[model samples]
Target: MPEYDEQDPVDISRPNPARMYDYYLGGAHNFAVDREAADRVLAILPETREFAMRNREFLQRVVRFLAVEAGITQFLDLGSGIPTAGNVHEVVQAVHPDNRVVYVDHEPVAVAQSQRLLADNPYTAVVHADIRDHETVLNHPETRRLLDFSQPLAVLMLQVLPFIPDTDDPAGVVATYRDMCVSGSYLAVAHSLSFDYWPGAVAEAVEMYTKSTHPLNLRTPDQVAAFFDGYDLVDPGVVFTAVWRPDKPVSDEEAISSRAVAGLGVLP
Candidate 1:
């Protein structure tokens, strides 16, 4: 096992995206700075917290759908934040205990939390790696041990793409994972959408979060769907977070993300 120590924290003085997101989800792993920043973002866009919850629901729905219907037992959750509420392993393992899950994140706190939460559970683990390093993530020790590349796996990029700038090849990051797993593999992804929902809502939210460690990169619907080029998108293709195979009927409140979008794609 590689020594999972602290990395280059360019500026730990300000709020971090992962930590701010954790704060939005009501998780305890965040700092006061993160909470303050999240509060500011919420002030700019009241729907920020609402979108987070809906995204969580979306993650659970997709995990269960893959585990039960797709018969996928391997899951690689990229940019997975602090474990809270309904997690991938909790949801999938409930359906099939043997299901294996590996969460990858560059956030130190997130990696630590993932380790603590999954220590006794051999089937699930977390690795510290950047989303841009697709090759390293694919070959990570925890990931290699828990996931079988030859079998069908779910590549989860939930609400993670926006963290990486288009200059870093965000689409390429997803396509790399898509091409690695075997033909029956699946992909579940969601990205912060552009300002289509509320004229200037997206841009305003981005401006609010600029104080955080990373700058946000919200994408348009067309740009978001392009991430699924190699695979066949499942029904209700590339729709808003609540619209993708929603577990329960989506209320007007849940469907608010005519702004953010999500979908699942199957390889074959």
Candidate 2:
């Protein structure tokens, strides 16, 4: 929990996965409620924090590969949480200074942070919109301003899809975004893994998170792979986030606890 002044709104009262994630990234935007809730679930699953760190590294490596290897200059990051260390824009723009990026998140805090950080940068913009609203997200004025849909852009859905359960048409939601992208566009995905390592811990964590403003919906490797249905996955496909493209050799203990699976795919 962070010490807050009266300016802090009640949005901090309820637990939010985004703010919790920001907390994991060692960012200062989260509240005591979010921290306490994250601490509760993490106490049950101690690996959660390690897994989050690996997931963030995966995002950074994947963005570098997409920008340098795939020659992508535009990026659309959905479910983008707080603007913290090594954000998508930072990584991508480092490789290509003119890279255009649009960060989208439904959280008010995330939106406010992005808007503040990106205010004067015409090459980058953040919009407060749900990724599920494919049309609205694609046609957003900010989206149109910062992205050229006709050109190849890297679309990142890291740790976002699980929130929209299959019953709500998660597959269709993915396809809608894929359909909008041009051939050779890239897709990056990362999500929580559902495995047998910690049944009680996982259930308790999910139960706690599901009660939050943003829901949790962990998925199997198959379900995670399915999200790449129509795309060509890059090398070392669909592995745990730590194993995706490790900046350096990751220890066994580090990899084992990194429960999330993340990968990059290219639309052919």
Candidate 3:
């Protein structure tokens, strides 16, 4: 656990997980409340910041692979949080300027921040809608305008599923999106592991998210893998975040011991 002053001044009035995540990534978009909450979470799981950074790197790699290798130009990023460097648009656009991206997030701050950051870009948009509301997200004017359903699109759900409980039918949520995609499209999902690597620390960290707007409902790799039904997984199916088509060498311990797991699946 990382050291922190538990009694630090905090604005509990509007604590948010997205902002806390921004704080974890060393971004200035977070508020005092987010910093305080993130600090507490860090105190319990010191590796959490590393895990978040790794997840971000994974998302970048996935987007780049989809754009450069898969030849995919359209991207739909669900639960896309506060904008930071190396965002989906920035990464994929670097590969091809014609690439289009649509970011979806329920957090108003995330949406607003994205709007401010993307206002100058014509090929990107930010939709303010809950990720579970697939219909709303899929049919939104901005989404429709930016993405062409006829072409292959890469759908990213990075570090977002854990906030959705089984009762909400997270699998069904994914299925809805999967069904909407055309053949040759891809779904890239990244979810935190429940117990395999660090059970105690994970449970405690989950407890912290429960106090925030989005409660963490961590699941096993099998449960998460089940969400990929109807799509063919890419190589290293449902492995740790660092192990899926890594850009550099990754140790077995580092790959398997991560609190998060991720994989990419292609529509058949």
Candidate 4:
């Protein structure tokens, strides 16, 4: 486990979305503040844990599909939170040992933990930078060294765009990244949906995130699909995360309960 001291650039006094996500995934990297905040969210939405798990499962499934079906060997995972089981590297590496993965995040604790976890893997690296900074992330020495822009790769934005508001032009940022990739490259995105299933509870849960280091910005399905403007969406297009190429049968209730949508697009 990675240890943090006062010298580390981490603020434990406030709730961090990365730490809260770790808490949701039942990881031990979170602190009391994070747990408390996550508990409040759980109180508002009892299925918060299930949502996190489903998001993770979606990430793993998509990466595996990119590696196996799409013939992709390189991955750039933006806003990758604290390292946990079934990471991008682990999922893709399983398809082929030489597959490379670069994880990018601005969270100090997440970067520290990822660095520690990937220390022994030559095919994987962690970049301590925000996803919105295309120059920094694309120009980082580790990223350039591990990933070749000339070849096809997959850019993963799983459950992270919710932190980016419209003022930042999240769609434009995605377009910038899309322009950086070559033809045949892929982009996979998963974003929280603003649905009316549980309006009161969901609104409260979204509000709770405003107090965290990263606030949530729920988007409609069409808004989420807009992120893939320059690419062709794979079969099923943007749909509930649970039904996006799920490994097993998913009932209508289960799909509706996902509370988020995901899709993979390929540059044509």
Candidate 5:
């Protein structure tokens, strides 16, 4: 891990969604402010941690499928949070050492930690940029070096779109990235479900996030599916995060308890 000094640009006073997510994943990269905010969300919804874990599991499963089954060698992970276990490069490189990956994030901690972790791996790199800025992320030297737009690569947006409010045109953002790739390129998305789908403290939890660096913008299933407009969804299209091609059997209760929806699509 990279050392964070006083001169670092990270603001420990405010809660960051990436750090809060790291806290939920039991990662040590988060600060007290993030923990307090995450704890508040956990108090409101005890299953928040479970949701985070499920989202990570979903990411691993999807990336593994893309690398091994779909035969994709390049990956562009947008809004990738603090590097945790089973990251995209780890999962893909296990299949083929040369598998390339570019991780994009605006969080200083996430970018720094990723840069440190990926220093020795020439096949991977970290781009410190906001995912919504498709031009910046796509044009970054690392992204251009590691990912080829003409080839079939997987673009991952797990648990990312919620941070992009509708006012920013999140669907258009996806479309922008999608248009840059070839027909066989893939798009994987996992987003928190709207309060209507998950009644109870979900609204309150979202309200709590409003105070954080990235405010949560939960969307309906239809709204989430709109991101895959130009692509054909894979089997079991747009289902609960835990139920999307789970490596292990998922109980009905576990599926219902999942607070988010996930799906993988291929440009047809």
Candidate 6:
């Protein structure tokens, strides 16, 4: 972790989206308010935890593919929640110890926890900044130090875009990052997608996020794909989380129930 004051305040009064996600992942970094919110979401959608885990799995697989196949040695993970099993650095570094990663998140507690977890890891660093502030995130010392823009890199926004509403120009935000990277750089994105299979459950989950710090802004597959406007989507274009290069066979039921879609694209 880069040297910096870790005195950022953590508001435990209201539920934080990141902490709630940590709670869903069965991590101990969450507070009571987070757990309460997570439980309510679970009540509305019994498969909430399953969806979260599957999304995580998708991220892990994408990281491994980029590291081993694409030969990407650096990663910028936006909205990387409380680090859990199969972190980007963990997955990539295991394949190539030289891989570097920079995690960006606005949540104070999330940043603090990440800082602690990566204290001894020189190749990884966390930036406590809103991903929407592209300039700050791109210019951060840690990011500049660890990532080489001149070379190919992987930018991951899995399960994070829904937090950015349309008014904020989420698509433009993505395009800015895309333009910043050199050609052949990769962009891995996953956002909540509502299918006909369980519209009611999707509505309930959306309602729950409205009360949290980051409201949900679920998008269709086409809408999500537009984020990669100038990039070439990799094979198995934007599909359900479990259906995206899964390690094992995914049943149709499992694919539809995942309720999230992911895509990998390369800048041309």
Please name the candidate that would achieve the greatest lDDT relative to the true structure: 4
What's the lDDT of the predicted structure labeled candidate 3? 0.87
Give the per-residue lDDT digits (tens) of candidate 2, residues 127-157: 8888888778888998998888788889999
> How does each model score on lDDT?
0.83, 0.85, 0.87, 0.92, 0.91, 0.88
RMSD value for candidate 4: 1.2
Per-residue lDDT tens digits of candidate 5, residues 114-196? 99899999999999899888889999998889888988889999988999888999988899999999989999999998887
TM-score of 1: 0.93
Ranking by lDDT: 4, 5, 6, 3, 2, 1
Residue pairs of candidate 6 with colliding backbone atoms: none
By TM-score, is 3 or 5 better?
A: 5
Write model 1 residue lDDT over 23-108, tens digit each, in one string: 77878887777888888778888778878887888898899999999899889999998889789999999998989999999888
Count backbone clashes in candidate 2: 1
Which portions of model 6 show Cα errors greater than 4 Å? 1-7, 195-201
Instruction: Estimate TM-scores for all models.
Output: 0.93, 0.93, 0.93, 0.98, 0.97, 0.95
> lDDT (0-100) at residue 110 of candidate 1?
85
Cα lDDT tens digits for candidate 4, 104-157: 999999998898899999999999898988999999999999999999999999
lDDT: which is higher, 5 or 6? Answer: 5
lDDT of 3 by residue, 1-268 (tens): 1222355332347668888988889988777778888998888888888888889889998999899999999999999999999999999999989799999998877887788899999999999999999889999999999999988899999988888888999989999998888999999999988755663476777787877878888788888899899999988899999988998899987786567899999999
Candidate numbers, best TM-score first, in rank order: 4, 5, 6, 2, 3, 1
How many backbone overlaps does candidate 3 show?
0
Task: Judge candidate 4 at residue 41 and give its lDDT.
Answer: 91
In model 1, the Cα lDDT at residue 178 comes to: 80
Error of 5 at 228 (Å): 0.5
Model 2 per-residue lDDT at 154 = 90
